[model samples]
Target chain A: MTRYFEDLEPGDVFETSGYTVKKNEIIEFAEQFDPQPFHVDEAAAEDSIFGGLIASGIHTMALASKLTVEETFDMIANLGGRGMDDLQFHQPVRPGDTLHVELEVLETTPSERHSERGYVTYEQRVLDDSDAVVLSLRMETIVRRRPEGQTE
Target chain B: MTRYFEDLEPGDVFETSGYTVKKNEIIEFAEQFDPQPFHVDEAAAEDSIFGGLIASGIHTMALASKLTVEETFDMIANLGGRGMDDLQFHQPVRPGDTLHVELEVLETTPSERHSERGYVTYEQRVLDDSDAVVLSLRMETIVRRRPEGQTE
Candidate 1:
């Protein structure tokens, strides 16, 4: 877990393990947080434009977040995010869809005011089993920088 | 849940009940999804720039999303979110903070490609107990249109 701002390159790629969407979890999440017909009611969803039950976009993002930390970001000197730009839902996440995440580092900037931290920008994508990018997000995460005179 | 595109006005405001953040929940969410030292380890957090345990930004958004549904969106003809823009984390959401959500309808437009549905744009904000905005989000949601000739 020694990853600091100095440890990451601009072109680095971080990947998360595959996670399958389950019907019950979708329903549960939708029931508690969304409750849209397209998300909560299977029969009604079949009649909607979506054609069937689909996971809420927030749920999809949450799942992607969970997977990213589990597989890739666990070792970094990670700080919380500052903001997100240009987040899009490219497609519906359906039941049984196995989703995987990829985050490409776009830039790393050392903080001028905060000596202990910096920001890392990433373009993150969530793809279904068919390799379709269902979600695309761009965000900057604050991370601790390498200590003074410490390369290792 | 009788809301339709035709019934919404641009200045409409939707508000949700307040929710208090718990230390264990913050730790649990971070343990599973964010896992940053500042978010998981209380001692480390006390030493970190945040100066105390704070919820993950994603966790904050999830809570806001949940409250939005429970208080307002549940009764609306919400289809699902299309995307989000200009999502910002303005301040740290710490344990014991009470959060409340408000969404203002920015605009509503009929879909050019679809006859039965339309998009509703909203500016969403999550305010802490002290009335500071901790999160700001902008997104579009698809909603069903009322019948061509029938109001009910």
Candidate 2:
């Protein structure tokens, strides 16, 4: 069931299962990587603009990446990511929120430098239980092409 | 000396202290948020395209965010992030590599909706110990405007 670059087409869509955001996990991750007041300290967060503890945007992105990898990348010949564009944090992710990802293929291009691999451009929208897009981004990834003699 | 919106000018620059990438930490972060074969399983990684286990791009980004917060955001009247653009992972981050961030203000715009805050656009470059750019992105954040009667 390994999907190569040739198998993905523009408009192909996939959805990932949910992961519930936990307050302790958020604080732990923020303490290690972000540590913004609103992300790590409940008391400081209460006085901040967010008015409560919230997951760091980087934490949300990581969550989205995890869910996407579990649902899709693990099933494909994904080499790695190249870059991302236009990442938007539409809504604050709270401790109790359950998040999932919906992704759609936007384009595929054969690599000029590598004949064995190609590139896939996809848009991922991370949504909460309420179906609101909490975060979104367009990612470009390297994917292996089907082998010369391999038939699907 | 809390720097407000009015205090940040285009071209202002800051540099953060370095953090060395640890193998165990990279594996731990990947296990939680990425879990790609090349990111989590060492044997699998050696056979993969990257040739070895490497830090996840998201992990690099999170590191950059932490460094920025420690170096600049903690000293500012910062509100929160709005969005990011053109995030490029220029190089793989390997264990034992030290990383730091250099950021420069790109622009500032008054928020049309919130008189109390303004927007600051900044570009951050995460560089390895060799000074090679490992990751880069532009971020937009909300910063409190200098309050009335406050002179500094």
Candidate 2's TM-score reads: 0.98
Candidate 2 lDDT, B33-147, residue by residue in tens? 9999999999999998889999999999998998999888989888999999999999999999999999999999999998999999999999999999999999999999999
TM per candidate, chain B: 0.96, 0.98
Q: Per-residue alpha-carbon lDDT of model 2 for A78-119, expressed as tens digits?
A: 999999999999999999999999999999999999999999
Best by TM-score: 2
Candidate 1 has a DockQ of 0.66
- Please write out the lDDT profile of model 1 over residues B64-139, one tens digit for every residue: 8889987787678777788999999999999899999999999999999989889999999999998899999899
Largest DockQ belongs to which candidate?
A: 2
Ten-residue region with minimum lDDT total, candidate 2 chain B: B69-78
Ten contiguous residues with the weakest lDDT in model 1 chain B: B29-38
Off by over 4 Å in 1: none
CA displacement after TM-score superposition, residue A92 of candidate 1 (Å) = 1.0
Give the Å error, residue B73, model 2: 0.8
Docking quality category of candidate 2 according to DockQ thresholds: high
Residue-pair clashes, model 1:
0
How closely does chain A match the true chain A in each prediction, as TM-score?
0.96, 0.98
